[model samples]
Target: MGKARANTIVANTIVPIAGEDEGDSRLPSRLRKWGSEAHLSSAVARLEALLADRGFERMPWLAVAMLAGIGIWFALPGPGEWLIALGLCGLPAGLALIAMRGDDRALLRNAAVAVPLMIAAGIVLIWARSALIGTEPVAGPRVAVVEALVLEREEQPARDRVRLIVATRDPLDARPIRARLNVPEEMDDPRLTAGAQFRAKLRLIPPQRAAVPGGYDFARAAWFDGLAASGSLLEQPAITREGGGIAGWRSRLAEHVREQVGRFSGTASAAIAATLITGDRGAIPDSDGQAMRDAGLAHMLSISGLHVGAIVAIAWLVVVRVGALFPWLALRVRLPLAAAGTGALAGIAYTLLTGAALPTVRACLAALLVVGALALGRQALSLRLIALAAMGVMLFWPEAVIGPSFQLSFAAVIAIVAFHNSRFVAWLRGKRGEGRGEGRLERLLHAGLLLFLTGLVVEAALTPLVLFHFQRSGVYGSLANVIAIPLMTGLTLPVLIGGLVFDAVGWGAPFWWAGAKSLDLIIALAHGTSSLPGAVLQLPQIALWAVLACVAGGLWLALWSGRLRLWGLAPLAIGLPALFLARPADLLIEQSGRNAALLAPDGRLYLLRNSTSFSAEAMVEAMGKGAQYGVEPFAEFPEWPGARCNGVFCQFEAEGRVLLVAQRPAEVPYGAMVAACARADIVIASRRLPADCQPAMLKADSSLLARRGGLAVDLSNGTTRAVRPQGDRHGW
Candidate 1:
């Protein structure tokens, strides 16, 4: 009897009695003890225990997996036609699997089966989006007289680019096509503004593909944006008609703000103000833009989550307070619902004013979802809410999945939401009231500390994305954000919002001036921080596979809720080393074949000409150089041992291989060219190569470049492997 009683007692302790607490029942004895000892509150402990319960519900994880699958689908080369057939089959198969298996694991099995279906759906969406854009007309560069209505006009660094919706092509019944027209700086006319219709000769061609491998494909981006062609205006466009409606109002507003700000302040300051108020970034100098990016203040210029959230919050608070003044109204209307509606309206209005750019559209969608959730008495901030927002955005703008803005914005928000909901944060917030009654100074310090912590969290969350996409990480981003974000949010943005409101009644001059003053301070802060040593850390180019792997691991860590989520660390560990191990191309050539660059042994990019600064900057950044190297002009080439240049051509040795960039094929002596090629491993000829001058060396001519776009040579091993931006022209 005694032995049996002891055995029973041991069994009872090992397991749990009926109707016991789920936390104590589900968790191991060690975990329960740790939770108790760690001062975890009962509610937090229960929440965590619930999250850890694998059988509780795993729908959110399944949803996240589907999203990942979709992202992976788009990242691949092209949408496979067979994916549609697969999706059609998988949907029914998933249903059958769920129906046939009534076991506890049925849901998990079903979810696993559904992932490919989701990916297939994504593939279909890509195909649908592409089909929607339609085929481009095979038109060559020719002067065609067309009557075009300007949809938008932006000032480029050297020229003005205008987007026009064609009204009429004089001789041809051309479909209303969206064409990009470049106006030379000298030929820019004040009358050629958005909402104005003009009759002008346009020398246009179908959108061009990426010039080199791994280069940005403007043509692909244009296809998604409904741009049919790009061209130059033969002459200054004559304004034959004026704009009306919303477009006209926006154009007038941009023009008015530009003029007023320019009159009130210096050109640079005015440009800043215009950017803040009217979303006109055209006047901002490249140097200032680069400084802003380096200092991590670039987001402030763009209307993103920060701006959208502020507008909605302010509007909600105002509505709630005003409603509270009338108790009956507040009670009847419900302050939450009223405030949410007001906030949503404000967000929508702001989105429209900003032209509904991708980032702004995403913000608006997220704001609306949050506000709607609040109105519906649901949790307004959760991983589920973020997933919903992401899915909604991807459903409409699938192309955005590849863009940095979408990826970074969503990642930061998800990480923030997850962090706020973590056990550590919960414990910290609980400790807030544990101390003695704090003084005002203590309270302020606490607030500042919280602000700093938030900034740190956001900066860390975005660091990987910044490195992967921009190849430059902001070294002082946390400090910069702590200083600049508050000023922008608490002062500049508020004043700007109020100014826009007051401007309707022509009483916004003071507010605008105050906003401008705040902007000046923000700009100064960015410049100061950027001027610091090592403000930006340029990282070597990370391989696409590594980026994908990291993203997968991060998603696992963030989207799942359990101790098992720690498994994500495995992929992160593998991906980080891969980033360092990956090497960049040895040589880069522009699509035009007019300029090229070589990777120097001293970890610097040696440019053939300064005119290709855009490509050179990309190369330098990829090589982990924070600053661009000097371009060695042919006439003033450095008389180095491995490289030499003359008026006709430039040659350099990299990785024990010599490359010759021929500038003047016709002018260069044939024997000299042949001799140079005979001694070289690669020759990039800007002009046509003579048939008889062929050498054993690899030859890259205008014809090959035209077909390949841009060229990159990988001489990592003993052999030279060339890659093009457009990939194999004849391959799928």
Candidate 2:
């Protein structure tokens, strides 16, 4: 018999002891019968108790890891050295993991072992990069060659300019970084596309950062895009063909697929197919994407765990069913192994299609873990296995740990696995068909039920992350998932397979129109379902305590059972009220180049500027958030109602309604109508402010909130005192 059959035998033999409910809380199977193992388990339990006594837990360790990530962000080389140093940082953590194999592994603090190793790896990566890269260039004049690889020459909404990533090469430079240059100029937009490359003799200087108050540090964005320096098109002297290694092949394939779809279908259909296949939604209009986001079907668009798992599952099923029909093939290679291999292939193909983005990398890691386990005949997968997989991948690619996709993907998976294992250990218990064969619908029903429960568990699990990163809640998300997920699994998966198959064959293939029509219908379903007005729940910018409460509550629910769930509600119950009470601003002055938005304390959201500008829309969206929670809004008070006025303010409606604005008028006579001047409510400056803009609050009773880039000033509760967001001397 093959390993799958052998495992099935062991699994069945073990299942008689493990899967069914004895209605007993503490019962051991074959592992428990190992009396010698008792000592080890007890020692591990004692160590866990000690850790509990010391107030150590996973969440705090998570915070520590993030702070370390922040440090890494500041410490790493300008751009080029990041890749080389990144792999080295996991050395310490990877080394520490080896100790878990010992008999007394339970006694040692895993975090103490792991975190040091992790930090050491980080330090090594950081030090090596910074030292070798030698002296990062600053934003100043430098004689350099501009090598630009145009990644995607697409027009941005509202702006006529085309955004392009010019691949730069600097051999003589201290640090060699391949970066994307953002040329926001519109006149030179239409000519460039994906495979285009340009070279120029231009002064490329390091990116700029916020030197003073109310400036959008262009350098920060440039840094995120790996663009270490910036310069305009000084002189386009030459044109060279550039290749993107793996990414180049993937981009070319993506373009080919997109063109194939477009020639056969409309632009929207092609765009949708490209988004699903290549993970490039830059071509998709913002309005369409935003509508999708509003509808809770946004996850379907992202190439995360769900998408990968869907592909794997479908591939595995097809391979298994087909292999079973081929008696000779099945006899030679076991069906389960064939299915697993097929799943692996699908997972890898999905990763390649998505340009191998970090999130997809993590997803592939996770999918590979499960598929590997199946091939290895690991019948009983545990939380330890899942955690080990996550840690292994993260340590291997530690930089991914800080990305939102990494955190949320692992978070959801961890929560679901934890919940499923805890509750369903004896899942086959107290059932009528415990020993009987189950039908397809019965299995489907069970799987659907599990998915529903997991969705709820995962959402609660990821609440902290969602709030911190996205600044919103998906109250309707579970409901949305319960309805849309089934469609995605059943309809969407089949359509993608059909499309892929059709692509491989000629245009005469019958699957082409069928797949395209199926895809079109799925799109229609999502559009119709997501059009519901109350499909999403938006929340406010909340305090750290609320976030802590949410995490604490999640831990309780995940780790504890029965009545403990009720206890978990306490943090959330209290946290919600606190969030409502802590409305940070009375009036929000959202600055746009065209018009500003004013959100009053009572929650009236109005725009000062009516012009259609990026800044204006951004401000309106923000102020509209204040309106969501019934913040009192004072009526329209645009200083430039008819004229182009530069400022907007709110003042003593009756006596003490504090006015907020970007600029403080030099001549406002009323002392009672005190302006938020030196103590600004909010500041938006076209030019950077001087270092000395930091000033004490001039308050009779109102408070002050002032910030100058990194420098900050904040007065508390009508007190003339100030506090920084971070407790440092430079806070005020």
Candidate 3:
């Protein structure tokens, strides 16, 4: 049988094991004999002894269970009555299992007890979120005349975009609404500053759902952010008032940095510097941003844990040194404590200055935790602390659990911590410690090896996530990081921070100049590495369940201790191969319905719509063809020599099937639909087609596209297979 059949067999086999009751008489006699009460009694005694010796290592498992529950909740199609029924049914069984496992006093320490409690708590968290932030849009899509205050405006090359807080949708009825607007480049309104009031006709629409099945979802993000809708201004606004406050201050700060830094750094470098310093990334060129992502230096573009940690470390060092200059105060006061306090203050100030984005907030929490631990003379970077930090984030922003940054940041740190304390790693270190050599060359080689190994470990841990979210792996990320991280972590961030302080004190020019130069080098490294052969690898889309399985297995490997840890290898083995079994669609149509692409047998992408370059680039990247490498429109950038296109339509043949794309009804060529009904496998018409032309062809018109947001067709098995927006798709 095929791999799919094999997986089905394994899933069928394992699911029963999870569902089987201990006393089920239907179980095989051999299994019943193996799982007799005597065996169960001995297992319980062993578990008790183990707990007595170790004093319950429950935090890691509890945290894992909670995280798993969150993942499960998000993966669910919808929160229906059945979910509550399922939970209600399971809760009693869980309670019974706990009761049978131990007495009341012992239940608190039992993993069996904690697992069910955490799962229920996670379900409750999701249920609460669903109640507070209902899945439905707050307002339907419609045109409205509104008076609004501009919260922020982003200056882009093509046009300017503004975030508005609507004071009233109607003149008589006042209500507050958060929205985003795009103002044309032709309109250079001086009154567009923060808190400036204006009345204009706007088309407000709810956040769009996932374009394709398993695609990006703006609706969830919008719900969390309390964004009512986004739209464009119909005409010049009638100004009502001038503005001031925090929003105004931030705007001025952004403008000042842009003006001052642009003078010395040039527009490109200055844009990068401004984003790092102010968290306004609208000015950064799309090409540069693409390079950063492709080269695996996208982390540097944002203010994250690494940047926050560096800032705190520098603050701590500076405060400690300054204190040393005053011997009297240094002797009387706890210098380290004073330094830690200073670092904590610095972290909080920076977080606020940068708008306190989610990543920054998470980093600040961790930095504060470290400082607090230091003040109390305890270990700062322990597993328990990590668990607590994760729990805290989840308690406040449970939805963040699904975000890429949260997953990547937490996974990297967890892997480092787990490996740093592992017996296998300890044995390796011991072996290294046995060497007495301390030559310069030896030290250099050792450092390089260590960096490479660390990168390998992090990449290994992030593989499933990268493939699931991005579909492309940064193959040369370690090499790129080796050259780029020290420059960023050591020089760029510090110089930038120092430059900001000096600028405030009227002595900043030279520091900003130095930071700009550092950025240029980093950008150069990114471009060079990304241009290297095999620097990025695209993989087939894996199902969410498979990704979650990989996560579960990884957590087991990282969190479990002793012999049980070995079992993690089983899931890892199963999950990795399952990824290959789920192949990419042979053809994909973007949500726009007007744009589509086909996957050539040799792994090239042939786009249908050449006009939609930006969205096409994104689609290409999501398909594992790196933006810089993917083939464009078959007419211009031919990947399939036989592909043909004209002014209004394009046609391509793949896997013995002909697919036709028509930009307009007129492009159909009077009798083409008649031929398509019998000859062509699929016809995608952007505009309405004549009733007679719709004969029996697999017609994908606007109506069909509305129901199935985007389309993915596969013909690898000599039969037509298609994926719709529904969760019924096999892979994703």
Candidate 4:
């Protein structure tokens, strides 16, 4: 019977080839001969079988195609009207093809036509979204007396600073604009709160661009967040109106939580408590934040999926237990439905209270979907649901497609779901179910193993993204998560929530103490694990294509089922090594051309300027050496190997090419400058050089740097790449 069924499956997958039609005279003889071959026919049949097996699982591919379109929109040099037009034209044709009803033979043909259309539609959607939210950035630095309403306020007690997001009328056009203002805490008025109108003397500047090539783009982020400018307050603000809104309430609640927690615990614990309750992370100390990042526990601090899920679960359990106590009320109203509704409400309320960050919003959406599934007696956790949630997020916030938060959160959940749904895991579950008489210790061991495996899979999924964005990832994250996750979800978070709730009744001290102690333990674990040798894996900057390849490979592995998914390993094998194998540029020139960094043969980075700045630190990070080999000022070691300086003209020789940097051209003789340029393959000067002083290969001066922005040069091949290419006019 098995052999017969297998034969039936094979027969079903086989489809007639075009070459099989003898009446088609246009067919090449070679193609007809190849189609007649049994092996070729078998290969086609196997591919068809794979597609057929995918069934509804193919839905996730639509999300992938949409994401590709969004990426293309961002990659274009300017507004992509041509691309949008093409997509819009193809939409109807693609829809017609998809709507055509056919047997298994037509599946591949339909997909080939529909996928590209979906990608085009994706591009169109993102372009429209960008246009809708587009706002002109602040033109330049200026000091003005601005009247604005505070939207949000963040207090940094350690730094004695307060940051405010304010909505104000633009002085140029009187259009509504949002500005981020930093004010000294001492200058801040006690009456200042969200919704309070105020007037202040402020110095505002256009948002900053990336300090180094391929580094974070604060300008782009600011653009998406609707921030027109950012600067510090020049004078204390005078409140024009009292605040009374949800934002005001949130600020007051956060402050209250912090004060109450601090009364029983240290300031660190209080800060964490405030963060957990209100998503106010400004209070977290830099040292504690760094430790959390190094130990890979940083996600715990973010009010994301784990936190939202816990809140929902706790709410559901509480409602169900309360319903059970009242048997008469439970009889008429379905307890599970009631519980699901209550849980969803809690998730939504918590999401709003935490400022509705993208991750939290996504989690809340997913939780709502899960509640709906439960109420409808459908599968609660599946790839289809995740795909739906992702599509929903991208529909509104298309820019998030490129963010690390969206990528990491979705990737981790997808990996977890995919891993647990594997046949091997299902088989293990079946085996465990059969052994229902197992001892309590055995059950605990099984649960622990499952947690460890889940953490391992999530860590593996997030590693590439972490490395791509931050240039570093924790090596012991999986093991740390195994211990930390349970402590957080089962004890600390619940206790913290309880403390906040009962504090109104003056009976929250014990809960606060317990929560603080748990936080202390988690913090200690982070520090201990982070202190271990090689706990963090520092990698060089990965190429954009390599990271995309890794993402594609991961999606392929997670979205598909069966032996065909093993093909994902091919790209993973190639992309993972590429992360470590990437080499830094031989020379880095800052955008202003006033400073630069040179990579020595010994792997040390030397900065041309004596002072370290953001550009210099970024260069060191790009070199993949962490803080162990901090950047050294060239003046400190001017006579070192492969380079020399005499306070005016510095010469560097790398990869058989000589480069000259003229720091003090006025001090040097004209003849010496010309002579140095003649011998050098590349010349860089603080000021524009005369035509006669041009180098053989390339020359970069203040004028050239101003036009091209920051540059990275590879002396080995004498190629230079600019951060901002000439003619670039992207909105961000």
Candidate 5:
């Protein structure tokens, strides 16, 4: 029965309001009043003014994405007519219109939106094109010539490896190389600074996509994170120092903090101190990182949006509390304004010190939005402000949209804002009054309930998409997060910050000790919680339709009413059953020494092939699943022999019964036995055995490839059917 006004749609969904909940009645009323023409026009006018004055600020990101896309497109070795049509004609023509033409502000204004959208789309197309560079599977020992700037540096606890970020200098088609050097504790290097360049000759591993369906595509994820490739240093990548700008001073300050912590305690403690101040944890051990990830406290290791928000808020409180001592000064300046300005300045310094990571930048951006609201002397923040912040983010770096960190950070803020506005309205009503028989504890409990509800709603909204894209989800997520969050917010982080100050003062041992203790406590809590059965859920890779259906269903359930929400589930209903329809089969039957479609009996993605017309592509697509179940065999074999030989009937027996055979050295007990052990209920095999074996079925693949192209034979019913195959070979 509720349909949010368009303005409500923009406001409630786009930004974080301070104290609101989703189901609150007051928000809709507020939005209805705010959605009036006056407010809409005012907001629109402000946006226009900003666009008119500071339009140039928006060009850097678009230019970079376009320049990057064009550079990548041109780097491709061979492009056909359509590629040429798209690149030379379509792309250049589109770019020429957007990039070159600035005849009028009106034209530029329109192009501003259109041009960037095109650039974003072009970047995606280029990525696909680059992956599909070669006709056959690309396999080669790659020797990369990299002239790379050090973007990041860190230590790996597993192999005692030190990793270096090297942004590629060449305008060629390639990945940015991040190389790790196996540095012994015995050796010392002169260069460890940012802006240092190197020509590294290395044996490169582009990225291993663990052939599991829907497993985390670490390689693809890394691409949007500005990582082109990862490799090991072949000959200690040739190093040359380049002068860093003012950032060098911050890096130097960070180095000082690290040294002081090291002098007082140890390197690990020093790393923790450095991370608090400069967002640098390069020296952290791999074991610690793994423990953190496994325990679901890994987010603490990185200077994420939450960490940044905490730092800003904590710093603001510290400043306000201290500033109150000087009453005369407080009279002249408002605490909120002073806090906002100071927080921004400190955040900038922190961002610079930390090497300006993507997560850090996003958090800083969110903080900047809050600061901007204060600066403008606005009592009530608008969602348009948030949307504009997003626009700014997208304008400068549209690629952020693809990254998980970006989505989660933005979504959390949106959720918080919605909750804030909704709850504030409720609090303002009679709901919070003592006259209504509510007490302080009751109110606190209600607030806690609201927070938990919001967190659950967000997790539910995010989970399906997360599972589909990442193939991993925290199962005991709420419990894990709840335990870790208090530790993160209270003891561990604050003491870590204090340790940084202590380091500067030359007496940080006590603070470092306390912080380390907090870490230990957190580790203990995490280890306990993570050991709870079902701490994580590993999901299968989903088809595109599943992705679409889930998204549609999520939006419908979140935003729509009863009937509409149910209809949204239509796509989900249609997709899940359909997925089982395309699963890979356990036993693929065909003639010897020829190619055939390896059918998935359960209709999961899979492919297998031999020397002939049977393309192993479907089997390849399904390889991810097959790999887990050991579906791929070096030779051929029957689907099932034990039951079939004794009692079952044959669907397509050549000599009468099912024959279990393997063309090469393979696992014992034949394919049927292995598959049956793996819980495959049915078996399909070759029709060349004796007549005794019953309940046995077979399909003559490839022998009828020409006559029955795109067919799946149902041996149980003696029926043949046509089905278009979905394979990565079509255009992976």
Candidate 6:
């Protein structure tokens, strides 16, 4: 009886009795102990434990913090001296905290202080760089006889023009300035090369602002590039000096490549060949470029990470294989070190040959980092390396952080690395391992699957950025890349490079022909894919907050490890749908007040003027509809319901309010305009309005537009927004 009572006591200790459940009753004691430990005493303890697990893995977050700071700087309308001061004060405080935490066991204490300081440091760095690189742009339109030295020249075969970046002295202040000049190709002067000096009668204007809200900001890009003005020559320039420099060499090589390829193939093939070799994409036809963009293969034309990485990889492989042929050399030398050195040199040479554009420079830096890691017998690809490369770029060119190229390239790489390192991929790899005795066909199928999956991942990663910048994303890009990428990278590029090398020995014709034929196939594929149904997904202008949320969520997902990272889906869920939910404005007015577009009830755009100018195109795109939903002239659509038009003015009713548009006010009598205005709820006029011609709600006339820049109106709530508001002191 005593023994039975003891057995019952032991059972009670091991398992919960009926109706007294504490936790999972089936779990073993060992697992129960782990489960209990997983539940921390408090939220603070959990956070501390999380920080400890992510100690060194959190280093990449510093780069993210820096990017956030840089973004903050650009978003400010003014210099933000107060922000700089705050950062300066905060930096030392953070450092002091770290210094004081000498032997603290809490990792959260260090992380809590470190992250914000890094962000502050980023703010300070970008501010200093901006001040150092500041340039005074041309104040307004002007004509001057400018003597300048050419810094770079780009040939536009399709446009029959040559564009030049020239350094000249501003006549107004005698300060140095850089201006872009367009000259006709018909007057192509052999002397018009890099290092060439010329004098010309020039017409110069400051870089243009965005035509509509949320459009590309050319002025901001110009500011970062140190370009003060853009213009065209009034007449033929007189060559003052001959040209000779690295730029001249690059130009000549590009021409040679174009001519050689054109002789065997066609003009389009030649243009693509030149782009692949020298990164001169201006010569590509507009239609072809658009097709490439639609197919999501436009990155091929740029000398960026993909090209550089391929070149480095080829160099490394060639060196290792060739060295292995000689037993003595292979046995004595460290083949990897030798190959890495050779690959680094090859990457640098290629970068210089491609004009060392900003993207090329960035790629070269990354390649060098990879090569250095290989030489030291360390892992070549990691998020840590990516973070270092990004931080390097931001330190030198903080402005690039805002550009699409930098953001897209880095985002794609980050997504790829993070996805491949996930537990899901590891499980997939184990599944493949289980089929180790499978046939060659199985291996090929596996490779194809991996390629397709990678393409999808890249497309998914780049979609948000594409929509944020271009307002469109390719839907069929993953399908297209599954075929196009192999053709271009595996066949076309290698053959083209080999042909160029063989050209030095006068036996490259066959190789060049092969490359051209392969390129034609890829081009055809691009056209076919781009023509498919729903190839592109056009979205409205996404709000800045939505983009920020997406970026933050993406970083969180990419930077963290384990199931906790899944929490990032929350922000992504909010942001991705917000891309479609943004409401486009009902009315758009150009800064001149001469051009305007109204959103009709049927979701069609009605333009004041029937022209396909920049303003018209911008208005149509801003409506969040495709270009197929084209704009019709108000004069042609005047017979539609709730609308009437005469020679000088148009009257329309929108969202329960009447609108009067004075299109040709100068041609009409003042009494007629006054009478028309008095009956309307809002009046938009081409010229300044008289005080007596006031409307009930608003009067957006020439004077108002001049002060407000461009305007967008929401008719539902009768709210107006400006592209540039009063007191905006942005340099751009």
Pairs clashing in candidate 3?
none
Candidate 1 TM-score versus the reference = 0.84
Q: Which order, best to worst by lDDT?
A: 6, 4, 3, 1, 2, 5
TM-score of each: 0.84, 0.68, 0.83, 0.88, 0.57, 0.89
Using lDDT as the measure, which candidate wins? 6
- Where does the lowest 10-residue lDDT sum fall in candidate 3? 723-732
Q: Which stretches in model 3 have alpha-carbon errors above 4 Å?
A: 1-35, 47-57, 85-89, 92-94, 97-109, 134-141, 155-176, 188-191, 424-449, 578-582, 628-633, 636-662, 665-683, 687-699, 716-732
Please provide, for model 6 over 1-732, each residue's C-alpha lDDT reduced to its tens digit, 9 standing for 90 to 100.
999999988768756533334476556666677767676435657776787888657889989988877877776666665366456648765775765464443566566676677677677777787777765579878798989999999988798899999999887887889998888887668688999999988898888777667777677788878999998888788999998988888888889888888887877788998898899888888777777888888888788888888889889999999999999999999999999999999899999999999999999999999899989988888899899999999989988998999999999889888888888778888999998898999888887888788888889889888888877777888888888877877878788898888999999998888888877877887789878988978876778888878888888888998887888899999998888787778887876777777777787667777576777667667776643543333322364467788767888787788888887888878798788889998888878998788887778898887666678888888888787755667666
Question: lDDT per residue, candidate 2, 565-660, as tens digits?
Answer: 568788878775665454432333321112334444455555544544444333433333622332233334553233233444333220132323
After superposition, which runs of candidate 2 have C-alpha atoms over 4 Å from their true positions?
A: 1-147, 150-163, 169-178, 182-196, 199-225, 229-267, 379-381, 424-446, 507-510, 559-584, 587-598, 606-685, 688-707, 710-732
List the global CA lDDT of all models.
Answer: 0.69, 0.54, 0.71, 0.81, 0.51, 0.81
lDDT of 5 by residue, 1-732 (tens): 145577787667644562467666676767677679678667655655655664533333343345334433433333453255344435544654665444433434454555555554555555464454422211334565667676555543334555655556322445334433334333314364457777656655444332222333444445444444555655655667663655455566667666655654655556655666676676666545544554545567778766777777777887799889999979988887888888888777667667787778877887788777776787434444555565566545654554567656655554455445453446654455645787789876765565556556556556655555544455555555665676667666787677667767767677767766655566666667656776654444446566556555543343333243367677767754543343332333332313233333343432233432213433333332322233344332234223232222221222233322322212324455444323322233322322222333433323333222333333344444322122222221
Candidate 1, superposed: residue stretches over 4 Å from native: 1-75, 78-100, 134-139, 155-176, 258-266, 504-506, 580-582, 629-646, 667-679, 688-697, 718-732
**lDDT tens digits, residue span 1-732, model 1:** 999999988767755643345455445766678778677546544644454475423545544544555565544444353455456647776775755464544444455566656666666665576677644543555568777887776655312444344434423545667777777776666566666788788887777665445445666777787776777778877879865666556656766665655655555666766666556677777677777888888888788898888889889999999999998897788899889999999889978886777889899999999999989998888888887788787778777887888888888887788777777677777787786687899877777777677777777667777787777777787788887888887887787777777889999888778777777777788889988998886776677778777777787777665586788888888876786576767776766677665666665556566544566555555556534534243222234355677767777766677777787888878787778778877778777776655544567778776666667777555433333333332121
In candidate 5, how many Å is residue 518 off? 2.2
**Pick by lDDT: 3 or 4, better one:** 4
Compared with the true structure, model 5 gives a TM-score of 0.57
**Angstrom error at residue 486, model 1:** 2.3
Candidate 3 steric clashes: 0
